[model samples]
Target: MTEQRPTLADVARVAGVSRAAASRAINGTYGASEAVRRRVREVAAELGFEPHAVARALATGRGSAGRRERIEILIVDPDPEAMSAKPFYGRVLNGAMRALGDQDIALEVRRVSALPVDDTDPPFGRVLINVPGAAGAAYARRGRTVALGRSAPGVAFVAPDNDDGGRQAAVHLVATGRRRVGAVFGPATPCANERKAGFLRVMSGAGRAVASADGDFTRARAYMATRELLEREPDLDAVFASCDVTAMGVLRALRETGRRVADDVAVVGFDGSALAEAADLSSVYMPVEDEAESAIRCLLDPARPAPARLPTRLAVRGSS
Candidate 1:
């Protein structure tokens, strides 16, 4: 087992002092004398018990008067390197860095996948980068972390108006008078579920029926599922693919089945990735950089009031 926790007794015994003395020294309380504090520091160093600087700083009010600097933009993605490589990743980072760049604060992108938190020093302050599932756990290590996602309360994470984006897609299909609508959805991501539910809501609201709905979060998986959906509804008039990658799959499948995009089966995608732009796919777009900025604000001023949802917009193109 790889554990990083340090016991108070370990620090006290090594210092040749009592636990009360060691605690007072670390806590910067009046309980310990100057000599006791000195011995406690020496023992802590020898035993490798890193002072919980963040926790200590809060209790002691040390360095609290300085400007709020260095916003920790923790990236919770499983693949840290790949996240750095992503075009959307760069855009979001640039957004965050640019915002803090003016304020002289740094944007710290930490991957929960690569370097796990050092419980040894426990962060002084934490702000969610994005993708709450991982950030939630990673920051939980520090104990004063905010969530930066849709519906993450008492913390900071931008919620994309996925439901509204979905409604826009459904309205596009309905306005075109497409009776048999089809869809390709990703698996249970917060953003994904919001977009899916939005589509269903709009369709149901308009008294239209969904010909087919498939759950897959990957490009390949969505491609296969879209192919099956097309087969299930040869007369399928419109389709909503949750993410841009998944939308690309849906478009490919529709073409393979001899359905013309917009002409035969209209299409729309979510997140607005590179493939969506390169292929010129019409889409409902969410500003990831704006989301990043919101995270920074929450970290800097907890009372700054986070957005309930980052506003979403639709970009109409050849697809829909």
Candidate 2:
């Protein structure tokens, strides 16, 4: 069994000091003197009392510091701010917004398409990024972090288990007796890599080696990427794209490759976006709304054990 975490009261009791003195010493604010701060620090270190904003707020009235947007979700990406045009982002933003509403923490969504953010702009406590980019993260102040593709220690993320998805997809294809399997993936998103890895595992499990090449999550490149993958592995019977956007592209390649859908090539996709229903693409429908919800929850409960991977389901269709 795990031991209970220590609180400030525990630290004060051990330090032989009052909780008010401990608060001032811990926060380094208003009333504590140098000797008291030193004593408190020593005792806190001994008791393992990590200062918590929620706890500190209750003691110091910090949480009520007026919700002038204390929590900000800063997007660090080279891509244009076309969030309104992208279905994937819209759903994610919706979930995040709803979660924020429940928490009552002010939230700001900003994109860094332009360089050298104005210093006059409010500093965010946390930063979010789509693809890996150290430049954006390097800008945040010390109290915050630069969130990358998915979750990492001390940072929050909202991404699928791409590698597991890949493995699952591969296993599915192989179980179906597909002798040759290929994959097309999204840009360098963490979800892309995990799903790709999962697909590779499935193919390998089914005794098929994957021919790897990737496409940006778009219909055109996905189509072209699929064509090339199929050309390299002519006997390929199944294709997996990292997302539905790419699946659309794969559809074109499959139709043109002279291979009968499912008979010769069964295509599967991830991110089961609107295209899955609109175009009848075979895919694993990720609980994007849930993904958003979890991202918010993780951000809120930075203290909790990393939440379990969110759920997803396979949506079989004409393509598969």
lDDT of 2 by residue, 161-279 (tens): 55666666666677677776678877776677677766766566556777767777767678788878877778877788888777777878887868787777888888778877887
Model 2 segments beyond 4 Å from truth?
Answer: 1-67, 76-85, 102-106, 112-120, 123-127, 131-141, 144-154, 256-259
Global lDDT of model 1: 0.70
Clashing pairs in 1: 147-156, 148-156, 148-157, 149-157
Q: What are the lDDT scores of the predictions, listed in order?
A: 0.70, 0.67
RMSD of 2: 9.2
**How many residue pairs collide in each prediction?**
4, 12
Cα error, residue 13 of model 2, in Å, equals 14
lDDT of 1 by residue, 2-23 (tens): 9866776899988887776577
Q: What is the lDDT for 77 in model 2?
A: 44
Model 1 spans > 4 angstroms off: 1-72, 76-86, 102-106, 111-144, 151-153, 212-217
